[model samples]
Target chain A: MNEMIENLLSHRSIRKFKSKRLNQQQIETIVCSAQHASTSSYMMAYSIIGVTDDSKKERLAEITGQSYVKHNGHFLIFCADLNRVTIKATNDEYENMLDNLENSEHFLVSAIDAALAAQNAAIAAESMGLGICYIGSIRNNIAAVDELFHLPKHVIPLFGMAIGYPAHHPESKPRLPIDAVYFENGYQDHEDALDRFDEKIGNYYAKRSENNRKDTWTDQMKRRFQKTIRMDVTNHVKNKGFNKK
Target chain B: MNEMIENLLSHRSIRKFKSKRLNQQQIETIVCSAQHASTSSYMMAYSIIGVTDDSKKERLAEITGQSYVKHNGHFLIFCADLNRVTIKATNDEYENMLDNLENSEHFLVSAIDAALAAQNAAIAAESMGLGICYIGSIRNNIAAVDELFHLPKHVIPLFGMAIGYPAHHPESKPRLPIDAVYFENGYQDHEDALDRFDEKIGNYYAKRSENNRKDTWTDQMKRRFQKTIRMDVTNHVKNKGFNKK
Candidate 1:
């Protein structure tokens, strides 16, 4: 594998971090790299917030149910923000912006834009020898997160990422067989595909050190699905300024 | 700007592509890079379908409403797939994999994972001197897309992308101002941020050649938002066997 592919293939999420701080130039480089990502129609309907405050980090850690949130060297939140565009289009000239982002397409565009940029930033960071972990639990309490971020209408926090130099290398997680995913012309729906996948996952999980937990991937997945604690996101997202309609 | 950042900053969608075929090793390298992206819980709940067959490309082109789809050197469809994990979890010692994916978190995770990987693939493609354009209109006819790919339940096409040697270099699109986003400490609302952004966008649009009918960013956004063409996705995605309940 080439350097990039090798770096990418040996990828693993890093949670623990060293105490060193990244210089502003490094952050700027990553941010610029992020800004270089493809935006839907150049709308650039996404924004990122770098979280560095101790209290804020603590609170975010508490909210995400992941205790490591506080100690990470960098915390950045990516938001699907059409608020700027919506209001801009509506305010002057010929169109209303808020009315423009009410559909599933724009929403998808915003999220995809955010995601694309985040990936670039993550790669850029990794190239610089930093480790990172994506924190999806930021959305566990949408309204609260919105409040914490002072997010305006038409913008929602998609997720937060914690980044830093790794104190220790975390084990690389296993992935499903590429055949299980890459279809030739279209998606193949063999009813037994998932069953076969589970066996592989079960073996993968079992091989992990016991410190990681003995639960099969399915067990964790089942537990996650059995509850509906964060189900209000649709309504909360709508209330926060995105019109799902 | 650094070369990567310059490439990123100068990114423009390339719809027209020269008929240059990507080698198998190139495809594998790009995917290996994609697989390096971060995944929530290391689940990696996503897939990419590489379409090179002429008839299949023609059909996908017809479905996405983008004529360039058929001509691109590479055509890829990225999907948010939860069925793989769900099926595995259910078939073995468990019977609730499908149920696990029913929750919003699992759905979001899959989508994010897919987007991250796709972005990596895009970057990899660009690094190799290829141009790319994302096809969000695939959602316009989700059922058709699903059927075309033989997608099973819990797998939804998020977006499609066409990559090839560029026939033309479209002008870079404008982005919203940093002030409109990038809140410090807590999220702060800014007044008139939208007006300023609109002016920037309007100026950018005005600078484009007059013959380009879709000149205004706001206008394009309005066209996207006001149209009801894409609303079928909510039900279409549901029909693919994902229980969003």
Candidate 2:
């Protein structure tokens, strides 16, 4: 395989990081690469917040319950932003601004746009020999996060990313078998494939280097789904003026 | 910048493609790279449908209103899938399957997972000297697209991708100014930066080889937001058994 493909295949979330900071050039290049990611209809309905203050990072670390948030070289929050367009419309005296932004389709567009940009940023950071981890736990308290970032209406923080020089290199996690994830022409039943994968994952969890346990994939999933997680996100999005319809 | 970063910054959508089909090995490697993308809580809440039948491609092209779908080497639909998890829970006799899969948080997770995987697949294809275009227009008639793929409930088709050797390479579209998209510590008003960028975009559009026009970024956005596009996706996702809470 080529270098790029190899780099992509070897990706793992980095939790521990060196104390050194990324230079200005690296940060600029990474953000530029993110900007280059394709957007739906070129709407570019996303914004990124770079948190560099030590106190702010510590607060974010507390919010996310991830100590690594404070220790990373850099922390950035990717937001699904319809506010930019709203502002533009108001300034230009365009009608239907609120109606357009309140629909579920626009909300989905912004969410997908933020994700595509963040993935590009992740890949770029990895290619530059930087380790990165996505912190979805930031959504554990969405309102507090929005307040912390001074986010306005029509702008919701989707996720955060931590980037730095790696201090730890964990083994890659096992994935579902190809047949289970990729179907031909139409969706197909993959119960047998999933059953076999459960055994493989069970072995993987039992044999991992750290935090090892004896549990299958289904076991973990069952425990996770026992109760709802982040149930307030829907209400929060609505309060933020999205999905009103 | 490194080769990988340069490749990322140089990305442009390929609308025209050579009629050559990808070898099985190349397709496998691309999908493998996609599988390596990070998933929220390891839910792996996504699936891919590879459509190679000519008649099916033609139908998809009609659904998307993009003729390039028929000319690409390959086409794949990325799906936000909660069905697999629900099925596993049912088979394993776990409770709360419907409750877990019907929430907004899980729906967002599945959408983000699908986008992350699709971006990785795009980069992998580009690294192999292939071209790709993400077809969000597939959402224009999502119900039809789902029917064409015979998708089950809890599985929503998110977007389609067309990949092939490049028959045409368009210039990269301009993005918003860095200050406008990236903020420090907290969100900031970037009206000035956006105003400056409007001029840059106006020039870009006027000088482009094809579809030349004299319109600023704000102009385009104003026209776009004048009416809602794809207003049916909300109901479609509900029909697919997501966001029911």
Candidate 3:
């Protein structure tokens, strides 16, 4: 593999960070990389909010329940935004566009758009020798995140990213076997050694320096799904004027 | 900017491909890059279907109404998959996870996970000197696509990436201004020169080699959204046992 592919394969999300802020050029380059991601029909339905104010960062960290959000060198909230299109429609008297943006299809478009850009930003940051973690916990308290970010209707914060120098290097988490995730022409589903993957994860956790756990992947997943999580997310998003229809 | 970021910034959707297929090594590298992307709580809620059969590619092209889909170096369908979890739940008898994956939040998680992986694949391909175009048009006939791919329940294909050697390198589509899509601490929305963006897009469309048009961005936006597109997406996903709640 090339150095770029090697860099990509070696990704490990960093939760603990040193206090080293990204310079202006790095930030711009990362954002520019995000801008270049292919959108669905050029509808760049996403935005990045750089939270530099200490208080705001603290509150955002609180919202996510992850201290890294506040303590990271730079915190960015990636938002799925159709508000810009709504703005254009209202300004240009294309009122039907508002209804269009409210559809579930547009919701998927904006969410996918935001995620693609955020992944680019993540890769760009990682290539620059910085460590980053995706903060999906921002969605745990979606209303607070919206309030904290002052997001408008048709714009919702999908996730956050904490970028900085790594204070600790975590082990690269093992992914599903390539056969399990990739199919030939059609999905190939059959019984496999579930214990094999769980064992690999189990070993990784066992050998890791911090927060060791004996739980298998399946156990964690079951524990995760059995409880209600962000049950109001749909209501929150709908009230924000997205997917209301 | 570094070469990687430059490569990311230089992305252009290639509609015309030289009929060269990616070698096994390149394909593996690209998929590895995608596999390394972060997933929500490591659920890894996605799968990829490689449509390598010529007949299937032709069918996919017809489904997408894009000829390039039929003649790419590789075509990959990124799918948001809660079905894998459902299968695990069935095997291990943790049925609550089934209900969990049905929630709207998990739907967003799966979609975001798929997009993140797809973006990584796009970057990895571009780094290897391949061109890519994201195919969102598969949603036009979701049922046909599902039938063609034999997608199981709780697995929805979010998009496809047609990667190939470029026969044509189109100009990078201009995006919204950095100031427009990005904010500081909070979202900043105010009226600016909408005509300026319209002019920028107008000039881009005017200068491009293929299919030049006199339409501005706002005009295209109005035209695209006014037409009801993919009205069945929500119902389709719901029928697939995702996000019905």
Top-DockQ structure, candidate number = 2
What would the per-residue lDDT of candidate 3 be over residues B1-245, giving only the tens digit for each residue? 68778788888888888988998888888888899999999889899999899998888888889998898899999999877665556544556676666678988999999999999999899888899999999898888889888998889988899999999767777887788877888889743745678888888888888788887776776678877788888788888876656
The CAPRI class of candidate 3 is medium
Model 2 chain B poorest 10 in a row by lDDT: B86-95
Native contacts retained by candidate 3? 0.75
Best candidate, lDDT-wise? 2
Fnat, model 2, is 0.76
TM-scores vs. true structure, each candidate: 0.87, 0.97, 0.96
In model 2, the clashing pairs are: none
Tens digits of per-residue lDDT for model 2 on B1-245? 89999999889999999989998898899899999998998989999999998899999989889999888999999999878876667544444767666677888888999999999999999999999999999998999999998999889998899999999879888889999999989999999998999989998988999999989888787788887788888899888877777
List model 3 lDDT by residue over A1-245, tens digit each. Answer: 67888888999999999988888888888888888898999888898999899998878777788999988888899999877765656544556776666678888999999999999899999989899999999888899888977898889899999999999978888897787788888988743745677778888888778788787776677677777788889888878876656
RMSD of each: 3.4, 1.4, 1.7
Q: State each model's CA lDDT, in order.
A: 0.73, 0.89, 0.85
> How are the candidates ranked when ordered by DockQ, highest leading?
2, 3, 1
Question: Candidate 1 residues B150-177, lDDT tens each?
Answer: 8877888888889889998777666555
Interface RMSD values for all candidates: 3.0, 1.2, 1.4
Error of 2 at A133 (Å): 0.6
Clashes of 1: 8
